[model samples]
Target: MVVNNGIANDARVIKTAAALRRAGAEVTVLGIATAGGPREETTAGGVRYVRLPVFPRRGATAAYLRFALARRAAHLVRDPRRWQRTLPSLRWYQRAFTRELRALDPDIVHAHDIHLLDTVARTWPPHRCPFVIYDAHEYVADLAVAGRRTRREVESWAAKERDRISDADAVITVSPEIATRLAAEHHLPRRPTVVLNAPVRFDGPADPGAPAGPVRSLRAEVGVSASTPLAVYGGALSTARGLGTVIEALPLVPDLHLAIVAVPYPHPMSQELRELATSLGVADRTHLIEPVAAHEVPAFLASADIGVSAILGTAASYDMAMPNKLFEFLHAGLRIVTS
Candidate 1:
């Protein structure tokens, strides 16, 4: 399975790999190493995980120069199109990914998301390739695009998807809406299989008599009492997430406390949210907790009174999507409050 991000927090990838492994197939998840993560490791489920660095560790001066350029593209460049077009890191990762794939030479290759299409295509030329499954995590073409240039960037991805969709032995996606759009837009022979981003439903612990581990709680983390009406938002801390709106509404519901459990805790957006909360005079009620592990998410969120999906319809993907957090909230048994 090929995904761009480190496999540590990617619940879908981990679950899929585990399922494939249980079915007697050896699974290896190839991805790019996240900040401070090990390049090579194995998951508890016994799946091999290899994460290649975006930049080469030992290479010629030109390679390092290209790495510098990529870093510049990431930090200095404001235009998304220019960032994507000029960045060499994607191609560098592609070459490294293709090399690892060649070494493994698995019978079946499952490429996750549109970003890894080129990597898979390079590894196995269409006609001669092994069985490949394309997992469309989102409607790439329908993603939020700001200007004409960014639209062109999305168009390039659409073109790539259009070209490669036919080559995939099977295509699966996160939602039926995305599946329908993919078929209609790409002129596919058949709609992709719909696989909702639902959590794996297991009964209780394997040993029913065994003591349960201490469950993390949003209320406990936020230092909120059992009676405090805590609303939890667990996902990316971004403008499109409509968290600002949620913060704004907090002033109206003076008694309700808002807890955001997200990654990259000290993020610019996190600061922005803090400022927003302070400005609205609800700072005391707003809490931002660092993200917990994927396995602990449901139990962690279970202590909250409500799960909030304050997604603003800023993009087509957001409009017709079933976010993983929604299912997690359901599993946690939290009452849902959406935008």
Candidate 2:
């Protein structure tokens, strides 16, 4: 089973799965299939892509209510707020994921995040011959740490994660900081594998194609003049992402157009960001837009002069994060400004 923790960054996972297949392994990706109803089947490269059944992700408010209702009484769970609404429900997904993994009966199972790490550590039966490998996408417990909540929450989650850490044949992480912390905390036998979050180095330059015209027209629709220096951020709009930094950066570069193409997250701050942008008197310059497909992201990023990626240092997860958008912006040839 080839598991990707999040839907916002599927292109990288898809590309990775394709390469794995070329090297001789049947791979199955677990997550949402598209923006519409969830579906599953083989991908272009013969790697199976399975979309788990999930609660519909409408917007910030609705998604929070849904998650809260679904998990009314939970201990030591991170704020569902940190996740993107488009992510398939983990609760509903676990069963289907297990069923398929067993059916596949692969030589190995590689998962993309701590959530999957926790899931497999607890459930993957001993009889199954699959040796598990986990990739730490982000340190989720750090979200609660930032809020100054009881470390009990983080500790509990970390303990479950340790269960995975002890058993996994291999552990890979996106950053050195994450690898260091996990190593220190768990008393790992040896250092975990560290893979920097970067696009695969292509052997040759990409063939030229025309830039997107419709997404470009979106700037005009929002009354953002074409001449204005466009500063943009994509992916889900969430609390921990520190979009306030994005908004605050707006006034610093006045006359700059800020395009926020936010996927609906189950965080209340998504709406608060809209209000904050409006109150900051930068509403006219700020274009709050809906999420776009992965293939279309380059076109949107291509039209921009700079990409804004700012997150507070308080959250360990945020501090350690190397989001796909950061790399995507670079791949799109945008300059990065971080705070």
Candidate 3:
């Protein structure tokens, strides 16, 4: 399996890897290594994780060049006339990515996103192609359309996705809505399979009730009185996630305090959130916490009076997404408020 993101906190990929391992398949996950993380490691589940070093060790030259090349490629894809200018840079990045992927030599290559498809395709031989499973986690084209990406970039990405899907042995998506849309968009021979991002199931008995020990301590640490109504948002601190809206609401809802558990990725929005909270005069009531282990998330949710998803409907992907965090809140018995 291959993915673009660091695999440490990718719940869906980890779950899929574990399931595949349990089904008696030897699984190896190839992903980009995060700063300060090991380049390679094997998990307890018997899945080998090999992280490709995409970023430079000390200098920013390589990283900047790669970014510039990616942008050039995007532009060239939209207007092929620019291929002469973009090809060299694009080839540099492609060669690096393909070099690492080719070392794996597996029977099947499961690509986790559209971004990795080009590299995966280029690495494997055309006549003797490995079984490729395009596991699209979201409608990336729509997502780019919703962001700062230009229409040309979006079209370029969409075209690439269509071409790759045509060659894929099978396609998999996170939701039925996405699957249907992808099928129609690409005019694929088969509809993509919908594998919902459901929360992991537990066979044990239901919780008797909320425990007071953790709740009481957590509240004290955050200076949230027992009587105060606390709402928790545990995910990326991005505008797309509607975290800004939640911060805006805090001033209006005088009695409520928001505990934001920022997702693992290094986010610039953390500063923005802090500024917004201070401006709104809700800084004292808002608590920003670092991300915790997956098993520890339930305890944090249980401590809150409510769980907030509030994801913006800027893109089709976000609009139709049945986010795992939503079910996580439900499983933890927190009342949900979604946008």
Candidate 4:
């Protein structure tokens, strides 16, 4: 299995690996290592992780020049301008990923996204190509709009994704909505399988007379008294996630305090959010906590009275998303107020 992001914090990837392992399959995840993380490690479920080093995006000036010159040279023969800008960064990673993946010589290659499918397709031998599973974690083409990628870049990805899907042996998507759209949009041969990002369910009863779970004094940690009602929002602190709306609503509900337990990625809006809270005169009522491990999410969420998921419908992907945080809140038995 291959994924672009670091495996340490990817709940879906971790859960998928664990499930595969439990089903008597040997799982090895290839991913990009987080800074200060080991290049290789084994998880508790016996899943092996192999991380490949990525090259610095800014320092590849010579490579970028070469790519530009190559594009000009190829332009005369065939149009290469469509992927010119993305090639500079994508080229190095593609080469490195291809090298590492080829060495594994696996029976199956499960690529997590359309971006990695190019490398997988390029590396696998044509005559003896392994069964490839294209796992579409989201409506990837729409992700360009969500992430604010350029039009050219978005078009490039859309074309590549459409081409890659046709070559894939099978496809898997996170939701039925996404599956239906992807098939129609890409003109897929068959509808992709819907694999909901549901949390693991334990069937057996808890240990009799076992020690109680660890206590979390959220009010104490945030320097608030027990009388204050806490509204918790956990997940990525991005603008599209609609965290700012929650901050804006604080003044209207003066008695409610918000605790944001989030992982800031791509953009950390914490400082901006703090400023917003301060401007609204709710700074004291707002609390920002670092994200916790997936195993601890339920306990952390249980410490609050209400769970908030006010995602803005800025893009099609966000509008269609059934985020795992929603399920986490439900499983934690917290009252949900979602957009």
Q: How many steric clashes does model 1 contain?
A: 0
Give the range of the ten consecutive residues with the poorest summed lDDT in model 2.
Answer: 204-213
**Where in model 1 is the C-alpha error above 4 Å?**
35-38, 56-64, 67-90, 125-128, 146-149, 202-214, 265-268
lDDT of each: 0.77, 0.63, 0.71, 0.73
Residue 329's C-alpha lDDT in candidate 2? Answer: 86
- Which clashing pairs does model 4 show? none
Give the per-residue lDDT of model 2 (tens digit) for 1-339: 455334434555655665677678877777644423565554543666777644445446765576666654453345533332222355645654666666666777777765566456546566654688877666755753544344655555555575556668888887788888888888887778877656544332221242333245445545656687887887655555678878866777788888777665334455677788888888778777665545456555776788887766876777887777787788778888776
Residue-wise C-alpha lDDT for candidate 3, range 70-97, written one tens digit per residue? 6555555446334323333335336456
User: Which residue pairs in candidate 3 have backbone atoms (N, alpha carbon, C) closer than 3 angstroms, thus clashing?
Assistant: none
Roughly what TM-score does model 2 have, to 2 decimal places?
0.73
| TM-score of each prediction | 0.85, 0.73, 0.82, 0.84
Off by over 4 Å in 2: 2-12, 22-24, 32-45, 54-94, 121-127, 144-152, 200-226, 264-271, 290-292, 295-299
Q: What does the lDDT come to for candidate 2?
A: 0.63
Q: Over 4 Å off in model 4, which ranges?
A: 34-42, 57-81, 84-87, 144-148, 202-220, 223-227, 264-267
- Candidate 3's displacement at residue 206, Å, is 21
Model 4, 1-339: lDDT tens digits are 988877766777777776776678888898886533445654554678878765433334775566556545533433223453444446655866887777788888888877788778888667777889998887766663545455555556666787667668899888888999998987888999987777654231122233344345555677667677999998766677888899999999989999888774423677899899999999999998766555556766776889999988766677777777888898888899999
TM-score rank, highest first?
Answer: 1, 4, 3, 2
